[model samples]
Target: MKFGKIIAAGVLAASLAMPAASFAADKPVVGLVMKSLANEFFKNMLEGAKAHEAKRGDYKLKAVGMQSETDIETQINAVESFITEKVNAIVIAPADSRALVPPLKRAMEAGITVVNFDVALDEKAKKEAGVELAFVGPDNRAGAKMAGEALAKKLGEGGKVVIIEGNPGADNAAQRKLGFEDAIKDGKLKLLDSRTAHWETEEANSVFANMLTAHPDIQGVMAANDSMAVGVVKAIEAAGKTGKIEVIGFDNIPAVQPLLKEKKMLATVDQFGQQMAANAIDKALGVLAVGAPLKGWVKTDIKLVTSDDVK
Candidate 1:
């Protein structure tokens, strides 16, 4: 009788220990790669992902930042490192859509699920690379259209305007420009000059200031992002035309709020960075934890915020 009782207790102990070991094995590891941590936008994305990880203790999140915005080599190396770590999955907002393809393909071949957000790989390239998942950003084209129409309304459809773009090769910039041009196709506005600002505020300021000198009659300015828009506004003010030429920008960063409140900035498109980050992290966790596949694109809506809506 004593021997039988001891055997039963040992069996129960083993059964309890088995489940604990299995649970530890089941915890998913996620890796996030972004353009750079220096930018406030990417920083917010990292914070949101960390918050999600904290809330759901079943997942582990590791975020890696690239050395620079244009450093595709660094990004590729980071992806390779993630692959060697044998993480369950990787979430990347690639610096250059095409440059990261080879490394991403290697990760996929290794049986690690990959998700691309923010920017995307080209369709053919993505197909060839065999990326398992993609979650694209909002409709940049629509957002640009909103800005163009708003500017046309403010300038009454018959004034010269200048456009400051993000980067020449970036899909987001191209899409935004297409939408803005489409909106103004009725000859309502004349685009005097369009140039790349490379998403740098100082560069945008200098470019716009020079353009103002060359085309002082320019009535409005459309910048691809808030950082450039703020720079353009500064240029306009420096040229002593603050109240003359209207300015509209995208990304609706917090710094632009004060400008909008004072009516210095006409309006901006809000991309909802925090919301996008939260959604991406949730999707990543779902795929890692449950083997669910994220297909198609996730569209986060953009809103136009003007002075009246600044509160």
Candidate 2:
């Protein structure tokens, strides 16, 4: 009778273990890999993702990324690690759009869903690899157009201006430059000089300093992002021409708030980093929980923040 009871107990334990195994299988795991957490933008993105994960318990979110924006190899390793862990889905903001294709393709081959945000993947690679389930981020062109129009209005009918571009091959930087040129197409404002600052404040400051010497009559400056804008503003101040030059930037970060308050920054375009993160997580959950179709794009709206509109 004791031996019979032992056998029955073993059967009951096995039965209980089966349901727990099934429950574990039911919970979906998602991996989010960003460019890096060094920047406030990516940090906000992580927070937004976490907030969404908290609301939806069925999905498990694993967040990891490079320590610095320039560490592409580290990002690749992180993605590989996610693949080894067998995540159901992967969300990434790639550092180099082209270079990341191979690893991303490998993830897809391993049956992991991949989503691209912030930066985009190369069109050819994206099509050929059949990776990248979706892209969610701002309408960069529209954002740039709004920023350009704001700068143009500040510069009046005619003025000389300099553009501080981010990275040379960065799609967002190129789009912003194109939008700015399109906005000022009436020949009212001439682009005196344009240089790539690589999104570095020091580089932007140095570029602007050199440009000032070459074109002493520059009336306005438009930077691709706020970090570069801060550098441009510093250059203007160093040259003793802060209020004299109209400066505008993209990404209305908290650091730019005081500058706007003091009327030193004319305006900035808000990319809504937090919204991007929230949306990414929402889509990721939908795919994991409901087996929803993952092939689509979501565009977040941008807002123009000026001194007058700060409140």
Candidate 3:
């Protein structure tokens, strides 16, 4: 499916069909809280959740998304609202790994089933709050490592590179950064600089353009997500260094296909974001059905994508 083309259509479907409270109150309700509706990854996820609801017709789904990737307050408020609604299950992709823990713990205390997906909540915070939520998502660190290793293979040893990171304190972002650092150590690459773009295209462009200015010798870039990669690629083009620099990113969003085919981007990792929420929802429903609480990580799939794969 061409995800980029379908975002608007999918969002339209989601908006028009948002589960109404007027539906039979006897049915189980699933509240989905996600980050950044502006992101194609989350948009596709929301679309998948909507389709899953339609296919099952057994549960009612109520989804909420943030205004931006780093909108922690909105996510907390969404959780509180869901708790107030007393939804049977709450499937969440947290904005801040730590800050969301308290509210989620409160949800659990209120007897609501909670499942964490996408970005995980901090383990320390969870332990502190006594929240025993199971995580259902991909191994973000491993996925990032796959992309980084691919870049390392292309650049070989001692390659000059910079990293454009996602939002600070986000578990996935931190894991991805560590994975990139792992590749740097294994590949013996010289790291020039690393900075956060908060997962915004424009911010990445500006940050990377400045990084390029400071370090014109940078041979490559590793963006934590495809959204930031779009900006990095743009900055490379604006600086007339498109072909001269190799770039790798995570999240194989549809927008990056042309960049990959054209060799503007080296590679990206696909974590099957569309089905992520549905999978988590299934897990949540299973617990509610059998009265068994889920514990530990329920790992999903991840794959590296390049020009060859796209073609």
Candidate 4:
């Protein structure tokens, strides 16, 4: 009887020695898909998420991104892989807003919670796909408006400027153009024309060079993203007009800080990539672990950054 008692006591001690959260293994597995691994913004996002996971150690996180934004089929395959893996939740920054809907809906239908960040899926497409997902990112339209407002102020009333937009098909790019248009609506600044650079520095450079040839008297340029802004800066320098025209961009990418401080670029909007990504991970865990219902959208904050704010 005493031997049996000792054996039972040992079992109890072993159970007590294990972490209460040992059952955490049963916690939901989360999958994160980014637009591209090559983008610095997404790199920061990955780092922030990893830091959050280290601190919380709550659920399993499987984060991966596509090779490039244009690789739509690959992104879809990534989602399918997650579906096969049976992840409980997924947070995605879609490459092409409309193209990603079908696979995303499939994930949702498979009982996986979906949280979208950055670029938004097309509303009509989402409805047609028959799935509703939560969005966690900055208010893209409002953020762009803030940047455009600053650019307009720098250019002053009656200034002539041009816009360098991202991929035309992306919701963020279209929304940013609207925000820029809204800011210039005071009839003070005239938009010579807007062109899509498709989010490439080289394309932005070539496009801006051509725009400069067509509109040499333009006073300023508003680029939808820092990558294109880099190209704009190069085109300006190439045209021997550096510092002669005002340049502003969105996304305070670290690479653009030197130019900002040099006063080559006026300002950029910081949507706080790190915080947005970490928050999205927590939101996913909330829905998966605690049975928390995901809501429509959780818009994060945006701040303006100049060269002085680089550090």
The most accurate candidate by lDDT is 3
Candidates in order, TM-scores: namely: 0.85, 0.84, 0.91, 0.87
CA lDDT, every model vs. true structure: 0.71, 0.71, 0.82, 0.74
Instruction: Report the lDDT tens digits of candidate 3 across residue range 1-311.
Output: 22221111100011112233423446789999998989888898999999989987889999999999888899999999998998887888888889988888777777777777778788898779764556656777888888989989999999999999998978999999999999999989999999999998889999999999999999999999999999999999999987999999998888899999999999999877787788777767666665666556656678889999987
* Candidate 1 residue lDDT tens string, 5-64: 000000000101112343358776777887756556677667767876787677788888
Q: Rank the candidates by TM-score, best first.
A: 3, 4, 1, 2
Error of 2 at 166 (Å): 1.9
Give the poorly placed runs of model 3, Cα more than 4 Å off: 1-25
Better of 1 and 3 by TM-score: 3
Candidate 3 vs candidate 4: the TM-score winner is 3
- Candidate 1 yields a Cα-based lDDT of 0.71
